[model samples]
Target: MNPAQSTQPTQSTQEKQYFDLHTTGIGYLNRIREVSPKKGNPFLACNIAALSGAADDVVYTRFDCRVSGKEAEALVRQYEDAVKQDQKVLISFKIGDLWADTFTYTKGDKTGQTGVSLKARLLFISWIKVNGQLVYKAEKAERPQLEQDPSGQASQGGQDDQAEATSSEDSPAPAAEASSSPKEAPRQSAQIALPETVQLSKDAPDFQERKAALKQQGYRFDGQAKVWRLPTDAAKSAIEAQHQANAQDWARSAQATA
Candidate 1:
């Protein structure tokens, strides 16, 4: 071996990287059918009228989705009869690998006009509500715990603990730790006690407006829990303030009527 060449570091092989874009929301299921393409396998496809904006002035964005996951496909197929019957089938869905496909209209009011269709693969069916009734909900898969040895003790316990401690030290400080103070600890703990998601009553004043605003700010509605969820404390504060304001307004209105 050449002296200088042997001392040099070996070049590492490049690994493949993937960029994924996923959209999750509630929508009305429509146009359910099995598409048998000339090439490749037959697949289930459907159109989703995704709901957005304020309830009073709601907006719908149509997505031409291919059912990708086996469970999602099964769930969608089960609702085909209901959809065909013209009954409303609402679902909380997750779509991935979205793209816009442009095509010329063959027949319609806009014949010979070019149109863009939003296309994506329906990867998950979070929950299904048919005609305002909860019918199907995807079960949350429990995470597998680390297995232990025959002795009921964690394998390589000491070494793993030391490694975890070292990793934590190298990582950026957590929010609680970064803002640590004698007076702030209790406040931090109280904040931590708040749930990851919150549900508001349909009868709440300006509920539609609040929902639209929160959705725009990246808060997702959890269909299963019937709640709006965001990981940030700021969102929780906003929701609390909205509730308080609603209460005060209701009280003032009652007094005036008396």
Candidate 2:
């Protein structure tokens, strides 16, 4: 018996073991299945109408960033330049209503008075895109026209209700008892309701804070990563110190050579 030949496993033997295991595994079967289509990165587009009635365009963008791989790549690339320089850049576009208010009231003995109470206003917001893509697109926003004049429900409630409410308000008696009693302290109003306060998470509570804190310490944020860089003064000092050290070493080297 040739001991060497007996001990050495044939090359075909190892390959067969691998082939058997591969065919039996579930993962191997999955690999044989059709390859899934690659889902492309998400993006946002804005449609704005020109107020003067001009042509418009669509904004396309993908985010590429460092926080997350492949996913943030497009987004980070989109805003990377601005973030590096600590500059403000367009983030997103918003469309909404501009409201106008007209007031009707009586002054002194004047029977009726009407005038513009509030001028119409427009609000623009810029922020991170919540969904797949983040983009800022601006186009003229048309102000809504009053097709049918808005009716003032409170104003049209009639003088009867107003007189009754006013009399009850001024009289020193409960609304129910006011009609019955001529003299009594007007029942106090239950209470007036006020809007609740809204609290917002700090601007990029994470990223923005890092940049702001560095700036407070006299460091400038720069580079695509928005690294905290030393200011000009500190940079100059560091350079000078390095140069001095180098000069001293050079002097010693030159003396030794001499």
Candidate 3:
């Protein structure tokens, strides 16, 4: 391996693990090379090859299958409908999982040929996660070897193209808000009454903490303008409660206070 070369994927330090079958170590995939005469004369033939993770164990009754034309489009519609209606559904493939990720295969008389022209049935079961959390897990049966089409293609049935937003956890979270105290500017709002010399200025210690405390109590700090505004009745009540508590404690005898 080149010293600088990386074995990990570019976006994350977390490694992706594949299926590991004992002995042969076939990984997580098994292939079906031949198509069988089925009960239905469909445009496409799909098979259910393997199930992975916790989701694959259950049997589903309302699965859909499509022939020759486009398995992904038809399957996605079925999957979406089932999910929306809260039904169980599985996708089958016209070819194996490996073939779905590849563009071309040379099988039988079509050796060395590109694209899917054969009447082969394949299946793949897959799970997908966003930022290490499962978003959708599914199975697909499709012929992935087709000429690039004018319409963009969805991934093979169970294959998921997780959005990058979902992978945010795998990457460093946005740098935490700067810890240095935020500078306070002179108050500019005419509505706020303040003494001329008591003008709020920048360089206050723990400004962020104070602001955060106020914010937690439903206050909004216009730091640039050096004004704090109450956002809700809760905030007004909280501020009044603090003052009342202080006054009540002050009323206690000096000896008792001391």
Q: Tell me the deviation in Å of residue 32 in model 2.
A: 45
Assess every candidate by TM-score: 0.51, 0.15, 0.16
Candidates, ranked, TM-score: 1, 3, 2
lDDT for each of the candidates? 0.59, 0.28, 0.30
Candidate 2 off by > 4 Å: 1-226
Candidate 1: which stretches are off by over 4 Å? 1-15, 142-258
Error in Å for residue 240 of model 1: 43
lDDT of 3 by residue, 1-258 (tens): 899997777766667765421110001111112234333222333322222222312211111122233434344434443333422232222332121101123475334432211112223323422223544444333223333347876443212333222222222111111122122111111111111111122453323433443444444556576665555565344444444443443354233535
lDDT of 2 by residue, 107-167 (tens): 6422344222111111222232211233532222321121332664332123223322322
Where is model 3 more than 4 Å wrong at Cα?
1-207, 221-228, 254-258
Candidate 2 residue-wise lDDT at 184: 25
**Candidate 1 clash figure, as a count:** 0
Question: In candidate 1, which residue pairs clash?
Answer: none
Question: Which candidate, 1 or 3, would have the higher TM-score against the true structure?
Answer: 1
lDDT (C-alpha) at residue 111 in model 1: 65
Top TM-score: which candidate number? 1
